[model samples]
Target: MELKSWFYYLITHSVFNFRLLIDGLNEVPNNRDNLLDTIGLIAESFNKVKICCSSRRERLFEQILQHNPSLRLEDLNYEDIQKHCYRRLHTTRARRYAYLVTEELRNAVNNGDDEVVLKRRLGECPGEMHKLFTSLVERQDKFYAKDPKPYLRLIEVATKRGDNNNHGAGAFLTFFELLVASSAQEEFISRVPKSLDASLLASLDSQAPDLKANVVVRCANLAELVPNRSDLQSYPKEFAYKELVNADSLEVRFIHRRVQDFLTDSEEGAALLRSYNMTEQNAVIRLTIASVTRFLATPYMSRVGKSLKWESLIEAGFWAKNGTGALDIIFPTLQARKPLRMPPFTAEDTSINGKTPPFNVLCPQLSPLENVAFGFATGFAMVAYTEAKLRALDLQKWRLVVGFSSCLCVRAYGLGRESSGFLTMFEPYLSLTSLTQNLTLSYILEPFTDVDFWVFRHLSCVATPRPGFHQSRF
Candidate 1:
């Protein structure tokens, strides 16, 4: 009562303007009801007194303050957030340009260029963000300038990866993966060490930071190394190669979304591509090859007889899904080998494994290369089939349907799988005349089973003839 009376006196008799602030009201543990009543009384009693409080939206507080003029923190700081982001981006870009200019100045001094000429070159450095990006893309450096294709390819891959909105979207290339990918080309392959060991691991660990720094420079500081969220250690134990290296847990990505935007913007993007003699298809092909090389190089079988073959296949599939004409190049290069065979699962195998193996019940006829190819085919088919179906649905055309379905059938046959189910699903749309006109399909499926041919003949007899059926192959 005395405390209440004191509060009433203070609220009623204060001559100057009074402002009261109670922060973290929800954190109060005792006498909250009385505190609320006091706050309500003070707010309602005097016109001169103003009260402001901060708390999370708890029901107790909401009951009293619901009708009052309240501002959310997000609303209050939205512009501030935008300003902070812009400031950081501007600062990073400014630093990069400064570095580039300094290097150019040093080169000019080495070459003994005239002062006026040097000044003119320095003046070429751009002031605006988009112009800066364009300048960076066009600029020549001593290190990467000789062979900018690899660096530009990396940028293209990163940009495309960002644009994808499907599964595994926004996943950046890990530093180790980037190193492998960047060095996978013929010119750079010799630089990769033949084997991974403790000594090599130490060397790689020491070189990783320098490599990351060099990558940023090569990319005109448009790319950055960020902490990788995926756990490398958790990979299957058969990946002894992983355990051999002290791989950095950092992934490569565009320094900013705006950098990606500048690279992907149609008009600007075309010029950028022309600057490096790069195409989107070529970038995907390079990544697919890189992934395959990495998978083959890493020994997936340990002395304990554990195999990471399935896991490796899945990893290769991830990259192969984006490939364009990759298989044609990849398959012919691989050496032919006998099919791999696995023994039947036993009680001991189940107990030792503690889980069902991924391919324990799989066919024994597929060689290691075939297994990898199957993985590639599976990924390719998933994306291709969806795209074809979407196109067919949008245009309401049977030609597109037959084209994609025929392609899928070829892939299934190549993987040694029956495509009867797939064919049956699109049976209604398959036309006899269209199917007969697809010579590529007929050639590819020439070795297919009698049952498949029978189905084709049956479809031809029952279905309406559709013209302009196109054929595609992997």
Candidate 2:
């Protein structure tokens, strides 16, 4: 039957023990307003039977419930929680060690009379979700005691896949995407076991297909525990990439949001993660950087790729700015010199000699100085990308410097090495001079030379300046 028919049926059967219960009403992704209005109408019209709805404490949900009387459900009390813990901890006599603390906790709670006394007896029973998750992991400690690497690797994939900063709804990855990223991530984590040594981490081969495949197999085997599937239907169809990922294996993320919070927020969770040495998670960030760079390097880009590139670039910039020395690690890797392609040349005239046709000339490779400049440009661009709004005034300075430097570099290359050396020394002082600060006057003097005009123009291309900045160019 149609939605209207269902509603009508429910409304007619109002007093016949009829009830409507909805969970996660606020989680409706698309047409949330329309859904809310419909629900509100049903709620207002139906007065006899019970109508109960549950939702996260998102602003919209709160706003909808503002005028209505509602009761906030607290976490399970001490005795109830102990019972739950005991159930999870219970096992056969051969595996009896698991129940030792659980039994003790149960007895302790049973002995107490008052709520306060029971709470004291339970003694830090991990009342919150984060603590609860931590307790669950600790319970499994005995099983993973001999080798925690696999377990730690699993947790990392599950937790790190979501937002660590507690912003937004967190990342939602499909099973396949998670599998690929996790495989790569696990390789990095296990490079040098039981250490966060930057040297070992830096030396790790992030490009190993064999290692990734191995990890993927390992993770797949342990799928019941780590990176477990989120509620697939909770997400909207548009939000989910069911077609791109396997239909049979369409998964969302980290069982629930509390699980994400437990991993992201708990001190014990943080320390546990630190023990595994998450410095290697840097590989993922570097990979993200490479993604952006590759897009930028492409000669032609589709509309989707262009939009994605912009997002990737912005994310890379954020990672560099606030990612706790991620930039430091990535910069050296990015700046590391690669062999530059030189123009093909021959030592002697091919027609005159019966000797081998083409002899390789001692062609110039990219100098250390050039590589350093490129690195600096890349780093500065990252900073500019993040601080475009917050530091709009400083961005003007950035534009001038980038544009002028671009011109100088071009001129030096176009002219000769001797000219490059001379300009290199004088460029810094010229930029610092008061004359270049007057952006409007500098444009007016464009007839004299294109140097200043070129600098202004180049900056505009690199970053779209704000309202006032655009006007300053004239």
Candidate 3:
């Protein structure tokens, strides 16, 4: 569909349809370059938009601004906007595009494109296309005349943003910035006569209405802050959306790439998991073969393999240079480490220091306890990166890997030996094992697998930290 039609589709859709909303952005031209730009546009177009993202998405946005200079995408500062949401800002610009379908947009606007399809597609009200057209037709003169009705419409739309709690204010605030860029904000504010602004502010009787006054003025200021789009008409319809979509795509990929680390870690270090009965290292080989086979068989990550013919990539000697042998990502922990050996959690196991060392045991690949530790380690690294304000995915991902790997390597030197208290496991299973059924297993798994003692202690560490009483550091 054409971009305008897609806009209609977007504005008319529901929140749940957001994923499709993003996927549909590809219909625009120069999709990669303009994704963030279009995203900003979509945000402004809506009455209220709330946004959230995975950390990876935030870093993706950071990367785009740094590497792609001319695009000049703004860094959305989540810290400044925390007043709007309970969580960290992780949503990519894709989310903005997804959120533009506000109730007002969903209200009948007539572009006269596929009415039946529009209703079936929009799913909000019956004959939505006609209803939308009617609103635009009736309001065009008022809008062009700079009447207060437009401001009222904006206020009314803002009122309908039921989910004001979830950064609706913040995201819409960014959208206001988008409107500023689009010259829409200036138009919007200009339409609000001083009398209307005064009246609205005076009558800002409701909570949302009160927020509306502040948000509108801020939006107007933000709009005024943007550099003028000297040649908005020159902006290509097809290319605008494409540019915005592409910007978003880079961010999404940047995040999933982080996920790849854990998956690869699970597989490489996962001693027992077998895809189609392929064993350990050989299974990895087979996994690659099966990947190629599956790519040949169908199309999943088929882009890497390219073209339908299933040629053996192994023979291609990717690292040899026909294709790149270099890994897309590196896991420093995946090296040939000391053998997976752990001392049995015997009664003799006791700590040399009064306080047992965190861990000294050498655990097997992806042993449940080890997986739990790996989870903790990965999570800890992620938190550190956030605290450090590193926003690039590769930087965060690799940085975490480096830190976690270093921690692991040092522990591998002798981590599990210190504490047997952590290796303990659930006691109910002891009955199944006879010995374990009667009592909680002793000796934490530090060096030994299935030692019941240390497991719980390690878990306590992984559990969310107990909230401390607030005290002034000063």
Candidate 4:
């Protein structure tokens, strides 16, 4: 019926992605006419249950205020951001970041009294957030540029300018990963390669995403960024630009690698790589420049890894076909505990099949119900004329973001014993153990950008139907 901007689409055939709202309304007509179920599935993708909402933007801010009038709101003012970030950098080239031992951060890891400080201070630090914001801001010219300064601050700018459609949760969540990955452990940096220059370390974040890119991550045993103190040490140029990445110099990569460590076993990092490769039943083999953490970011990738060409699946299956399911399924597919099954779908009842849509046929006698008043609107308020008609239902604009924030509260508290008050307060608000288990997970999931609009209709189950509350696959 209509065609949207091709550039706006990853799947090229749906207007239902809340983020897609910024684009022209060209692609929605077809899906509206041919695939109502697909639209529904896209809407359901916002399900970040720990937040107890799909997180699509509906200006959730006002709505959240209505629910919790006392909820805190950080003013992302440029000056305030600068002040918070000032803590990150030195007044001069030679100033040092108080590299004070952040031990309580780790000590609180298992469940301890120091957990609250870790959650409140370390988790929401102004400096860390600013770095992310700066990276996002610079994205106009240099998103993920071959520099750490750009990466940290670019993400910050993106957050402060929260998207009215999907809110700014995805980028906001990325920060938690940094905190998790980059612990201020005193000893970890002892292993950092001294061959690289300290000044050049800030360039690593931009380098990490490239498939063939070569980068090293470590913490500096003795490193500090002083704005004007170029005299502290004479460093070599070869190691300065691309090789040395650490917390102060290359914050993003340092944080990212820590998260990378959390995802894959530390001991296995080296062994996982070979000129060729080795097979691990649980892990993907044949390591490449592109990390596994990068591959599963999109649904299309998951689908490709799951479904394959006819000849490939058949050709590989003739030997025994016993593990045929695993061979043809999504590569490094997210595992369940003992047995895994694709998400449930409704088995259709063909007896009632007809030209009429399923909802109308479900209750022919009640078909007249479409005329009843449901809200401030006239008749058919809830009666969607087409599946595409079922759209974002927002009583408030920022409600999705606020709802998502609520989920983060649960996760922050639930992950460790820290922030017990916040944890306990928000504990009742959400249970996103599934989503959290996969939180900030770049490759384990199919990236939202790759979802196929037409394929969405194939989903018969509710969004995020986690089978066992306690069991999860990495």
Q: In angstroms, give how far residue 373 of model 1 lies from its true place.
A: 5.7
In candidate 1, what are the lDDT values of residues 1-474, reduced to their tens digit? Answer: 998789778767767788988899988888988888888887887888899999876677888788999988978899998788678757776766555556656656666776568788778877766776676666647556655646655656645654554322234555665665555355323322232234543444455566665776677655666777743534445544442243436667765566766876846645555667755555554554444444334432221011111112223234333232333334323323222323333445532255422221122233344333433333333333333323434332344344434444544453244454444445545533434333223221123344334444554422232222211111
Candidate 2: where is the Cα deviation over 4 Å?
Answer: 1-131, 141-170, 184-252, 280-381, 384-474
Worst 10 residues of 1 by lDDT: 303-312
- 391-423, model 3: which lDDT tens digit per residue? 233432333322323334333432443211111
TM per candidate comes to 0.41, 0.30, 0.15, 0.17
| Higher-TM-score candidate of 1 and 2 | 1
Summing lDDT over every window of 10 consecutive residues in candidate 2, give the lowest-scoring window.
356-365
- The CA lDDT of each predicted structure is 0.50, 0.40, 0.28, 0.25
Error of 4 at 117 (Å): 11
Q: Per-prediction count of colliding residue pairs?
A: 0, 0, 56, 60
Tens digits of lDDT, candidate 2, 106-171: 544554544455556366555444444565556443434334333334335434534443211134
**Top lDDT model:** 1
How well is each residue in 176-195 modelled by candidate 4, as lDDT tens digits?
12321222212212212122
For model 2, the local distance difference test gives 0.40
